[model samples]
Target: MTGISKLLMTLGVIIFVVGFLMQFISLGKLPGDILVKKGNTTFYFPIVTSILISIILSAIFYFIGRFR
Candidate 1:
C-alpha cells in the first residue's frame, strides 16, 4: 500500500487499541488532572491525560519515523 494509507491504518489500529483499553483504564481521572467546583459551577480538565497521550504518541511516531 501507499505511505499515507499505511500511516492511516497504523493510526486507526492504535486508536482502536487505546479505545478498547480505556474501558478498563481510567486515564481521565488521573491524579494530575484538574477538577474544580464552585457553588453551582464545575470544571474538569484532563491535563495529565493529555500530556500522557502526547508523550505516548510522540514516542510512537519517533519510532515509526526511525524505521522509515
Candidate 2:
C-alpha cells in the first residue's frame, strides 16, 4: 500500500485498540482533570486525559516517523 494508506491503517488500528481498552480503563477520571458543580450546573474537563493522550500520540507518531 501507499504511504498515506499505510499511515491511515496504522491510525485506524491504534484508534480501535484505544477504544477497546477504554471500556476497561477510565481515563476521564484521572487526578488532574477538572470538575465543577454548581447548584444546577456541572462542568467537566479532561485536561489530564488530554495531556496523556497527547503524549502517547506524540510518541506513537515519533516512532512511526522513525520507521518511515
Candidate 3:
C-alpha cells in the first residue's frame, strides 16, 4: 500500500475506535424528566448477534475465496 493509503487506513481505524468508545461515555439517564423505558422486551442478545453475524460472514468469505 502507498503511504497515503496507509495513513488513511490508520485514521479510519482510530475514528472507528473513538466512535465505539464514546457510546459508553454517555450518562444514559441524565436529569431528564423521563428516562428511556422498555416494555414487553424479548430476548435481545447483542453479543451473540454480533458473534453470529461475524462467524457467518467469515465463513461466507472463506468459501468465496476458496473458488478464487
Best-fitting candidate, scored by TM-score = 2
TM-score of candidate 3 to 2 decimals: 0.36
Q: What is the lDDT of residue 31 in candidate 2?
A: 95
Native-referenced Cα lDDT, model 1:
0.90
TM-score computed on alpha carbons, candidate 2? 0.83
Q: Report the error of model 1 at residue 15, Å.
A: 1.5
Listed per model in order, the count of residue pairs whose N, CA or C atoms clash below 3 Å is 0, 0, 0
Q: Which stretches of candidate 2 lie over 4 Å from their true place?
A: none
Q: 1-68, model 3: which lDDT tens digit per residue?
A: 59678667655875686579768755323343243347864443355445655785587557645654
lDDT of each: 0.90, 0.92, 0.57
Residue clash pairs of candidate 3:
none
Best by lDDT: 2
Q: Model 2 scores what on Cα lDDT?
A: 0.92
Tens-place lDDT per residue, model 1, 24-43, is 98788899999999999999
